[model samples]
Target: MIGLVMAGGKGTRMDAKEEKLLLQYKKPVVIHVIDALKSSNCFSKIMAATSDNSPNTQSLLQNNGIETIKTKGDGYVSDLNAALSYLHELTLVVSGDLPLLDGGIIKDLVASYDGGAWQSFLVTKKFLDDMNMMLEFSVNHDNKECYYTGISIVDPKKISSTNTIKETYRIIDDKRLALNLNTKRDYDLLKGA
Candidate 1:
């Protein structure tokens, strides 16, 4: 499976002068995501999905010898679709802003795929509340609200045949999977940890 990092979002919620992926906690946030993917040893190839909105992010990864692909920067779904179409294989997609995510969690997610076309890693609202993370969005799952961890395994062969795709929503209770760096508050929380 190819490892794809989505790094092209504008990150308007971060309200920072620099791209969110370039912001440093210990090192550039996106690098942490990339390193975690590498440590998982899950992909034959790993690439960052970049865009015009994040030229600096694209340059940093490229300069460091990481593979990158430019997308339309229109929106998450569109950019993701563009990347999946180009990859044309089974892929593990992760948000570049998840600085705290680690390889073990990734490996567990991969192990749980069960041959589904897509498997989304999610966190329950209770987990978000316990972490004091803001609830940006959620969906009803087994009578509980679940938040997307921005991590998933996708089969690119099924990209055009959405109607026939089988999806699994795996709810993880780990804080590492819950901390998505979207806002200043989220960054501050990560820094304080």
Candidate 2:
């Protein structure tokens, strides 16, 4: 599995230098996510897709020997699809903003995946408490039901079918997926709430 981290936004919502991916917890947000993936031994390759054309993000990946993909926010699926283009195997795509996630949870997602039979699979879970409140997503059903954890396990070939990569998720569950840092409020909430 290839670990994909999406941390490229211009930090528009926060309007601060704190791009959600770079936001801090005990450490930078993206680092935590990357470390988790690395620790899982679930992915053979680790990639980060970002809108930042600067060398900062790429440098980080380069130092770690991970692949980097640049994307556009003009469309959700389009950006994701473009990033998926560089990968050819099963992949784990996650947001760079999930600071509190445990590497173990990612392993669980890898273990729970059914491969979608080339269809795609996502980690699914429910919203029941404050921790659940940290996550944001609506549960949906279509011959199935799940509140898509932003974190997903998918066949790159299947996702590559679409030309869009932004907001590519269609269905899933997993509350731990939502604690992304989008604003100072989001960061503060994460630090304490």
Full-model lDDT, candidate 2: 0.65
Candidate 1 global TM-score: 0.96
Which segments of candidate 2 are over 4 A away from where they belong?
A: 53-55, 73-76, 117-129, 132-137, 142-147, 163-175
Compared with the true structure, all predictions reach lDDT values of 0.88, 0.65
Taking the candidates one at a time, how many backbone clashes does each contain? 0, 22
Total clashes for model 2? 22
Specify the highest-lDDT model's number.
Answer: 1
lDDT of 1 by residue, 70-165 (tens): 899998878988888788788999999998988898888888886778988889999889889864668878888999989999988776665666
Looking at model 2, which ten-residue stretch has the lowest summed lDDT?
A: 117-126
Q: What 10-residue stretch in candidate 1 is worst by lDDT?
A: 158-167
- Over 1-193, each residue of candidate 2 has an lDDT whose tens digit, in order, gives 8888876656566666634565667776788888888888887888988765334655666677777888875443566767877888988878777776777878777787765623233333433343544334545445433444457676766653453533333443444455667667777768784
Residue 26 of model 2 has an lDDT of 75
